[model samples]
Target: MGIPLLENRTSPAGARPAERARRRRYALLAAGTAAMLFAVGGRWDVPLAAWLFPVLLLRFTRTTGPWAGTLWIWAAHIAAAAFWVYESALGSGPVVLAGAAALSAVQAVPFLLDRLLSARLGRWTAPLVFPAAVAATEFLITLLSPFGTAYGSLAVTQHGDLPLLQVTSVTGCYGIGFLIAWSAAAVNGFWQEPSRPSARPAAACAAVLAAVALAGGARLALLPHDGRTVRIAGVSPARTVAAAGRAALARIPGGRQGIAAAPPAAVDPATTAAQDDLLAATRREATAGARIVVWPENAVPAQAAREPAVIAAARAEARRSRVYLDIGIAVYDTTGPAFGRDETVLLGPDGAVLWTYQKAHPIPGSETYKPGDGRVPVVATPYGRIANVICYDADFPAMMRVRADIMLVPSHDWREYGRPHTDKAGLRAVEGGYALVRQDADGVSAAFDGRGRVLATADSFGADRQTLVADVPVRGATTPYDRIGDLFAWLCLATVPLLAALATARSRRR
Candidate 1:
C-alpha cells in the first residue's frame, strides 16, 4: 500500500513537468511570431519581404486556440508595424506605451480573424478563407481610419514591382493583399501536413498567380503612352520658420521679392520669409527649363487669398519666369477658434489664378485645422488636366477621385518619417492611374508615374535646398479602380460574416 501511494505522488509531479514544457512551447511560438513580423516590416522597402512574411506567421498560429492566437497576432503586428507609433511618441512615457499597445490591438483584429478562420475551416478552405478575412478587415480600416489611410498595407510593399502593382487598377491594393495572403496560407497548409498535403490549394494558388502575371504583363505592354510629357520641378526649402519667429532677411538667389515686411497685427514676419524662399526656389527651377514649379505645403505662412502680398509675390514669379505655379498656403477666417483651410492655388503661365481647392483630409492630432468639405477639382492646363491635394489629402483614395493627367501634392514630413511617408503615398498614383509629383519640405520629394514607378526623387535631409525635375507622363490610361471603385472590398466585407458563420459552425461540429 505504501509503495503504491508513493508511485501515485510521482505521477502527479511528472504531469507538472509536462505542463511546464507546454508553457515553454507557447513562449517559443510567441518569440517566433515576433521575429517573422519584424521581417515583414522590411517589406516597406524590400519587395521580396512581402511574399516571405506570412509563412512562419500562418504556420505558428494555426495550431493555437482562438484567444491565444489573437494575442500572438497582436504581438506580431506590434513587433512589425509599431515603429511609426513609437516614433510618434516624442518621449518615452507610459502614455506612449499604452497608445502603442492600443494601436497594435486595433491593427491585430484582421490577422486574428485570419488565424481563427484558418483553424476552424478544413485544409481545403483555409487558404481562401484566410485571405478574405484579411481583405475585409483592411477594407473596414480604410472606411474608419481618421484620415482614410491604408498606410501599413502589405500591397504597398510591391510598389516597386510594376508588373504586380498594375493590379491595383482593377481591385485596388486589397486585391494584391489577397494574393499575397493566399500564397502565404497555401504555403502554410503545405507545411502543416507535408506528406499528406492536398494538391488543390497549391494548384489553385499557382493559377491565381499566373493569371495576375498574365493580366499585368498584357496591361503594361498594351497600355498607350501617347500623352504629352510635362516637365515639372518641385522646389523644397530646407528650413521654415514658425509664424511667431522673427523674420530673417534672406536674399532670394534669382528673384527681387526678398523677405518683405510682416502684415499688420494678424500676419507674422516669418510668413514673408517663407514666401521669399518659395519664390526664390521657383525662380531657380524655372531657370532650369521647368514649365511647372511646385512649392511645398505651408510654403506661405498665411493664406494667399487673404494676403495680397503673398499672391503678388507668387504671381510675379510665375509671370517673370513664364511658368505655372502650384503653391500651398493656410486660409484663415474669423469665424471659429480654429478656423482655417489648408489650400492649394494653381497659377497659370500668365500669372493669373487658374484654380484652387481645399485639402479634403486634415491629419488628426497633428493638425488643428478643421477638415475641408470633400471637393476634388481638376484644372485644365496646357500640359494636362491637373488635380491638387495637400499632404494628408493624398492618403485617402476617394479624395483623389478625379479625371486628371497629373496630381500635385504639396507635402510636409518630419525628418524621421520622410521615406515611408513619401513611398506610401506613391500607391495612390497606381490606384488612380495618374502621375504623382510631391514636394516635401522636410521629407523625400518624389515623382511617380501611373505605374508606381519612381522617376526622380530628392532627399531633403541630404541637402539644404532640394529639387526634383522629371518629365511625368500625362494621365492617359483610365484604371478599372477609378471606374468601379471598391467593388472587391465590398465583396469581401459581405463575405466575412458568412465566413465567420461557417467557421463557427465548423468549430461546433468539431
Candidate 2:
C-alpha cells in the first residue's frame, strides 16, 4: 500500500491557499536549516560539510529544474566566506557572524545566474558556476581590500593532498582548486548510474601531482644544510626611529653617546667597531668562501644605493671578505620615498646589488613601505635566481608580479606574532617552489622549502641569533602559481557575471 500522501492535494486542480501556506512553511523551515549549515559550514566538518554535499547534490539533481537547489547552496557558500572575513578582521564574534549573514546576502547575483545557466546549459554546468564565480569574486575582492584569506576557497580543503598540491608548484594554488572542484563535478555527474564515470582525468591530474611531489621530495631528501659550521651572527640593536636626521647623526658610531646631532662623517669608535665587527665577520666568512651570509630585515636602517657611506662601507666589506652578503637594508629614496615607500635590497658579490625587489604590496597601518613601479628585478647567482621581499609584503601571493626561484623574505616579526610568522611565511615558499629565508629580529627566523616544510629553524629572536646558512638547490621551473595566476578565481569571475546576464534574460523571457 502507498504511504500517507501529505504532498497530495485535496483539490484536483491545485492545493487550497491554506494548504499551500502549510507546505510553504515546511519548505521554508527546511531551507532555513540548510541555510544555517551553509552559513556555518558545519557540513565540511567532522559530521557536517562532507555529508551535506552528497545530500544537497541529490536534492539539486532530483529537483524539477536544473537550478532548483543552487541558490540556497550559494547563499551558504557566501555566508561562510564572509564569516571568514569577519574572523580575520574583527576576530571571532557574534558581530562577525552577523556580518557573515549579511555578506551571505551577496549570493543573490550568483544564485540568479546559476539558475539561468543551469536552465540553459542543463545538468552539472550550473554546479561548476559556484566554484568558478566564488573564486573570481574572491580574487577581485582581494584586489580591492587586502583583508582575510580566501577562507571560502575550496583549495584549502585539499590541503592534505600532497600530490594534488603539487600542481601548485607549476600553476599555483588555483590549479588545484579547479582540479578538486572539477573532480567533485565529475564525481557528481557520473556517480548516478546513467553516465559512466571515467576516473582517468581525475587520476591523471592526481598522477601529475604525485610525480611532482616525488621529484620535489627526492631533491629535498638528498639536499643538506650549510654543511660546515660557522659562527653566524644576528643583531637587534635598538635605535629610536623618532627622527631620521637624529638617527643619521646617531650613525656617527660612538657619537651615539654624545646625544648630539653629529655630522654624517663623524665616527664613534665603539659603535663603528660593532658595525665593523659585523662587516669584519661577514668579510671573514666571504674570504673563507662562505656560500651565504644573511642579516635581518633592514639590517642597516638606510638604503644602500642612495646612501653613499652605507654603500661604500658594504662594498668595502664585500670586497674585503668576498662573501655573498644577503642583508635586508631599508632602501631610502631621500628625495622622496620612491612611490613614497622604502624598499629592501640584496647586495650581491662585488657589491653589484644583484637583486632589488620593491615590495609589491603594503600592509594597512603599515610602518612598512612599498616598492617602485619600475621593476621587480630578480637576480641570478650560484645560490639561486632570487626574489627578495621585506617583512609584511610577503603575505601577498606575489600575484601580478614577476616570478622567482628562491624568495629571500627579510622579516622583522614583532612580539605579537613570533614563530607562527615563520610558519605562515612558509606558505609563500610552498606556493613559490623555493625554500624561503625568513630572517627576523623578534621571531622565528627560519628556512622553509617549496613544500612548506621548515628546512631549518631559528632560536627565539633577539638572543644573539646565529645565522642559518643552508645550501639550497637553485631551481628554474615555474610554480603552479607562476603559470595560472589565479586561474580558478578568474574562471569564477567570468562565470558569475555571465550567469547573471543569462538569468536576467531568462527572467525577462519567462
Candidate 3:
C-alpha cells in the first residue's frame, strides 16, 4: 500500500512537468510562425521565408489540438496583418482593422483544413489537402474579391526567382503558391514520422520542384528573342512642377469642394505649367530616337471644358514629333457627378486619336472616379499591337490577358508602394507573354520584357528627371495560361473537395 501511494504521487508530478514543457515548446513554435508570417509578405518580405513559414505553421497546427491550434494560427495571422498595415501605406483605421481581422480569419482556414484532414488520410494523399486548400482559397479570393490578386499571393514573394516563376505561365500565380504549400506539407510529414519510408513523400516533392525549375530554365534559355524591338520612352512631370500645380489648386476657395463653383480660368494656370513640362519632355524623348512616348497617370489635369484643348495640344505634339504619344489626364467636372475622370488617350504619329481608355479599376477609398467598363482595348500600331491600363488595373491577372505585344501601364504610386508594386506588375508580363512599360508619377517607373527581364528603370524620388527609355520587344508570345485561363487554379480548387471526401471516407472506414 505504501509503495503504491508513492508511485501515484511521483507519476502525477512527472506528468505535470512534461505537460508544461509541451506547452512551452508549442508557444515557441507559435511565436516563430508569427515572426515568419510577418516577414513573408507585404513590404518586408523574404522569398525563402515564404517557403519556410508554412512548414513551421503546419507542424505547429498538427501537433496541437484542433481548437487550440486554430486559435494560435488565427492569432499569428492577426499579428501578421497588423504588421502589414503598419508597414504599408494602408492606414490603420477601424475599417482597415476589421478587414485585416476578416482576412486573417479566412487565411487560417487552410491551416485548419490541413490540421483536420492531413492526418485522417493516407500519408501520400494527406499532403495534397493542404496545398489544394491553400490554392483554392487564394483563387477564390482573387476571383471574388474586389481586391483581386493584390494581397496574400505567395507568388509575389518569389518575384526575383525568374526560373521558378515561369510555372506561372501555365498555372497563373496559384501554382507557385500550391507548390510552396505542398512542399510545406510534404516536409512536415517527414518531421512527424522521421523514418526512411517517411522520407519518400518529401523526396518526391523535391524532385517535382526540381523538374519545375529545370523546365522553366529550359523555356527561358530556348525562347527566341530575335523579334523586332521598339524604343519606348516613359515620362513624369518634375516634382516641383507637380507640387506647384497642387499648391495652386489648394489656394482655390473651398478647395476640392469648391471645384464646381470655381471657373475654368481659375484652374488653367495651375495645370498649364505641368502640362507644358510633360509635352516638352515628350518632344525631347522623341527627338532622342524614341518611337513611343508615354506619360504617367494623371500627368495632365484639366477642367472639363478645357479637356478638348488639352487633347488637341497632345495630338499636335505627337504629329510634330512623328511619335506615338500616350497621354494621361484627369478631367474635373464642375456640373456633373462629384467624382472626376481618370483616363488615357493614345495618339498616332498622324495625330489621330487611337484609343481613349478610362481607368477600369480605381484605388478604393482614394480615387472617386466611377469605374470604366472592364474591356481592355487593343490597337494595331506600326511599332506593334499595343494595350494600356491604369496602375491598380494591372494587379488583376485576368484583366491583363490581352493579345498585344506591349502593355503600357500608366501609374501613380506613393513612395511606400513604388518598387514592390512595379515588381508585382512585372509578373503580368510573364503570364501574358507581353512586354510591360509602367510610367509612374511619384514612384518607380520600369520596363520589363516578356521573360521578366528588367529593361530600364527610373525612380521619381531619386532622379531629377523621372524618365525611362527601353528597347521593348515588338512581338508577344502565346502562353498556356493566356489560352487556358485559370484552369490550373480551378483544378486545385476541385482537388480540395475530392480530398476532403476521400479523407471522410477513410475516417469512416477506420
Candidate 2 local accuracy as lDDT?
0.50
Q: Tell me the lDDT of model 2 at 199.
A: 49
**Highest TM-score, which number?**
3
Candidate 2 lDDT over 51-132, as tens digits, reads 2443343334334243434555555555455544433343445545554554454433433443345445435344565446
Alpha carbon lDDT at 21, candidate 1 = 58
Q: Estimate the TM-score for candidate 2.
A: 0.60
Best by lDDT: 3
For 402-495, candidate 3 gives per-residue lDDT tens digits of 8889999999988877887888899999999999999999888999999888999999999667999999999989899999999999998899
In model 3, how large is the Cα lDDT of residue 65?
Answer: 82
Q: Where in model 2 is the C-alpha error above 4 Å? A: 1-121, 142-161, 177-289, 302-306, 331-341, 355-357, 368-370, 398-403, 415-435, 450-453, 459-466, 479-489, 498-510
Residue range with the least summed lDDT across 10 consecutive positions in model 1: 252-261
**lDDT (C-alpha, whole model) for all candidates:** 0.71, 0.50, 0.86
lDDT (Cα, 0-100) at 326 in candidate 3: 91
**Tens-digit lDDT string for candidate 1 (1-510):** 897677567753465665665665576566555444433323224566567666555655676666787787787676655654544333445554564465567656656777667667776776777677667666666677663553446676666677887888888888887888788888777776765456678778989899888888887788756757978999865454432322432322211112122233435455666777778878988888899999888766563344667787889889999998998876554444345657778888889998776766766545656666777767887777888888878777766766788989999777766666777788888888889999987788999988787989998878667888999996546888999999988897787778788889998988
Tell me the TM-score of model 1: 0.84
Worst 10 residues of 2 by lDDT: 39-48
Q: Candidate 1, which segments miss by more than 4 Å at Cα?
A: 1-32, 35-46, 79-81, 87-103, 119-123, 195-197, 221-224, 238-268, 303-306, 331-335, 503-510
How many residue pairs clash in all the candidates, one count each? Answer: 0, 21, 0
